[model samples]
Target: MTMTPSLPSFDLQIDRADLLEMERDVWNNASVPARLKIEDNMYDVYIRYRGSYTRALEKKSYHVEFEKPGIWNGASEVHLNAELFDPSHFRNKLSLDFIRDLGIHTPNSQHILLTRNGEPLGLYLQLESVDDTYLCKRNLPPGTIYYAVSDKANFSIKRKRGLTSGYQRKLGNMQDDHQLIHFIRSINTSPHEIPRLLNIENYLRWLAGAVCTMNNDGFTHNYALYLNSEDHLFSIIPWDYDATFGRKVNGDVMEYDYVSITGKTKNKLTTQLMKRSGYRRRYKGILEEILETKFNKNYLEDKVMDLHSSLRPYILMDPHIHSDIDSYDREPSFIFQFIEDRKAFLRRELKKL
Candidate 1:
């Protein structure tokens, strides 16, 4: 085996063990403000337990926020994604790269080796958090309303859960919900009004990315919706792709284009939009274009191989907390097989449209 090329890495050290202990307590499921140092630079941060059930695991994903500006490349916070599901640990990174290649606005991420109290914790995927800082970095105007969709966020007129729990507020006040609520109602009831209230092109591209990658959990949840203050319309952004490529969120193998022929999602608003022949055809066209240009199997395989080779050394030394590392090689190979099989499956399915 050869040594992999060096990439940007972060070495983290925290001041308080008690705060970390609180974070690790599954029952507490809480966050504590603490001082953290990354590569000798210190900052104020809130370390919080994140993810639905992933919090229960020994290796838990984290929501980390830095209060000061210019903490890290102009980022206020980043998601420390604990890749607990697949041993290969490149599923989320690979999927993000694929989506970005397709021109969808997904979070930028990199592999980071983390440590606490100078001891190696394990490999973590550091992802840009989607919030005001994210919007500012993109040159998007301020006061943009950001809503994080989850499994329960069906965009239904009838409320299933609390009005607040379904969608998370990132940038603006709770009053901003009126616009989104009205928009969701309009989507379900007055389907024809969609083209006026939403950024259809961006949503379609994101949907296309999800379909090509077989992200079963992406549509209803694992996505962000941003309301461009200027136009008052919404845009969809991809999130939490750890279950992408070949499997559903629950670790089930899924067929490519698992949701719909034209890449329509399980999202209620998305379903309503796909009812139109024009949108359906447009989705087919978008998916075809992605398959031809960005989602190339050879390109993806090369990318995956580079990642596999690069991470091989780290994987050998990784004290991974929850996953079965014995299957590391097998998992990456399965992902490769998924790309080839998914590409073929999508090609065949695209022809049906």
Candidate 2:
């Protein structure tokens, strides 16, 4: 016998025109008006497919933008993650939970029972989308330069390669690429000078977070960089975490200490910064603090178990389980084992510092 956990509900209503378009195989960049009802209240949302991998799924993830906004608990938009990768349907949840606990600039999320036009679409992770409103909600300056980077040259001398090639500008009014060019130049030319152009503590925490979670995809892509208008520094924000917690992009399995857990990254700036004596020490200290505090295996195990227990009953109700419901049902304990093992391995690995 198992008990299901309580979660929020979203009954989504998309018009037939949009529904028809969405059902097609090439619905990657399509959008439709969606009427979403949370309890008796309703909000008009512009819904569209928004992900590289998840775009190819039968049950896909979505980006929901509110046409009108006042900020509902700091969220101006939302994403419905289909949890296509992990059968336990908890990897993204666990990752977000870890990020929030680390006290970083990350989108808040929760498990929610989703219904499509009165029928169950299955369990989805309803995540708050990180955008301009996210900055405002945290009382951060609205003029921050935000980039949704999805390519290589990730924080490198992108200006040297081509200003238009590396990342997409989400906000801010840049007269030209000079600001980003200068930032990249500073990072490449003077690593010690980063404190003038970036927030050291924020950078340290972000690098530490990726290492702790073993987010293999986070270094160059799968991340958002915000040049804080107030502080005039760049900070990393986490995104797309189903590939973490013992998994790699090439289908390789990750063990504890799977990654270097240092600032050394494909991104030139991160690699250069980590080479510095002071930055390396600070990064090591942050890792130690994480291992001692929030990333403690026992604490994480409790969360994994709780998520699995609550979702067990609902997972049974899910029509799409990749292989079978039984295999899916057993994934919690498997991932839980990963969490415990990863922590143990890191402890032994980080004991040097």
Candidate 3:
């Protein structure tokens, strides 16, 4: 007997007035009170529009916050990503899992079906929020977390023209800004202090993951920095990876060689580290190891195929991305080709380092 796979469904019920207010100001951070029903359990939650440009899209992503703790697998908050930009709808989870395999912390994600006020919203990728609960789940020590909201989050002293800071503090007090400011200053002025202030090994692994996944937009933004309270060292976690795996953030098909093996150099930390032979050699070694193990044609093909098989049944039901159904079905081959070409490119580039 063959059993069909299914996804967990969430029914969100919001007041008509609240829903209208939310739709009126899509960019506002204010969340409207709502009720989320999962099977027989109904939870009090707050729902709001999530993502920058996604708020303007026909299909929208949402940020859901539970009024109480320990809801939905110990997550108090979750982001429901519409994944409108990716044809395959697998790159975000795949990239995060790949980074986790390399020993860097990443958000846990899964596919879920969402409905608002009895209207079907289709498939969404529910991503675990990086907060105190996330740390507790992994049994990590207390730390401060900041989201790299823009390119200015680059480890540089200069802020983009009018912006004050590129990062948004998710946890910790206002004093945490001083620590991040000091770290940025050190990155630009005191290169030798990097080892003491930053977790070099973890950063190297994260860098390697970003390079291998070809997340061109991940360098300065789309990541989280965790400042360990005990050691006062910052470690990065990958985020917003739907743009990875041979696809641009805008849903364009990216060239296999679009990103270099060394990754983006605009960031002061990465640029400074790459100039040092020791860090460069270590990064090269990490890239080599990943290529030999996880980034190969065989391993990635199986992964893409498995994801495709699981999502094929649901892809057609997703109104946002289903318009290009053929593209979704054929994405596995495209991704496999990207992997084969990228492995060769990285290997050749690694030798040059």
> Who wins the lDDT comparison?
3
What is the C-alpha lDDT profile of model 3 across 166-195, one tens digit per residue? 889999998887888788888888999999
Top candidate by TM-score: 3
Error of 1 at 92 (Å): 0.8
> Which ranges of candidate 3 are over 4 A from the true structure?
159-164
- Candidates 1 and 3, the one with greater lDDT: 3
Report lDDT per candidate.
0.75, 0.73, 0.88
TM-score of each model, paired residue for residue: 0.90, 0.89, 0.96
Native-to-model Cα distance after best TM-score fit, residue 18 in candidate 1, in Å:
2.2
TM-score: which is higher, 1 or 2?
1
Ranked candidates (TM-score, high to low) = 3, 1, 2
Q: How many residue pairs clash in all the candidates, one count each?
A: 0, 1, 0
Candidate 1 vs. true structure, TM-score: 0.90
Model 1 misplaced regions, further than 4 Å: 1-3, 7-17, 20-24, 27-29, 68-70, 159-165, 250-252, 255-258, 262-265, 321-326
Question: Please, what are the lDDT tens digits per residue for candidate 2 over residues 323-352?
Answer: 457866777666767767776776786655
Error of 2 at 184 (Å): 1.5
Judged by whole-model lDDT over C-alpha atoms, candidate 2 comes out at 0.73
